[model samples]
Target: MTETEVLAVAGQQAIWACLMVGGPLLGLLLAVGVVVAILQALTQVQEAALAFVPKMVVLGLALMFGGPMAMSVLRTFTEDIFAQMVSVGGLR
Candidate 1:
């Protein structure tokens, strides 16, 4: 592939990787925020901690569990990019 074409593909792959890695954690935070907002409305609890704690806990867990998989994906991407760089004469 031409260098421009290869770079475009690599850029697309990196964007996809970001979405996959962040989608779960962002989804969890969204769900938790909605729940916390509803609960606050029902009980008039205005404490920021109430809204913050669950999202933090759940997102932390998501990262803890998915961190390895995310790292693996990223590492593989890096290796591929470097390989391509060498192939395209960008690296020696």
Candidate 2:
């Protein structure tokens, strides 16, 4: 495979990695936000800061749960890119 092919593969892999890593956390954040909004509406408590803590906590937990997988994906991508780079001619 040529350098361009390697790079294209790596780029696509990176994009996929990002989506895989980020999707859950983003989805959770959205869910939390919606729930908080609904609660605020029902209770009529317009405290802006109320949403902050729960979202942060949920997002943090999501990241903690997902962190290992994310790191593994990133490591694999980095290793692949490096292997390709070595095969393609040692950093040009």
Whose TM-score is greatest here? 1
Q: Highest lDDT, which number?
A: 2
Where in model 1 is the C-alpha error above 4 Å?
A: none
Least lDDT summed over 10 consecutive residues: which range in candidate 1? 83-92
Model 1: per-residue lDDT, tens digit, 3-66?
8998998899889888888887798899989999999999998998898889889988988998
Q: Rate the local accuracy (lDDT) of all candidates.
A: 0.88, 0.90
Q: What digit string (tens of lDDT, one per residue) describes model 2 on residues 1-92? A: 88899889888988998898888889999999999999999999999899899999998888888899989988988898889889888766
Model 2: weakest 10-residue lDDT segment is: 83-92
Clashes of each: 0, 0
Clashing residue pairs in candidate 1 (N, C-alpha, C atoms within 3 angstroms): none
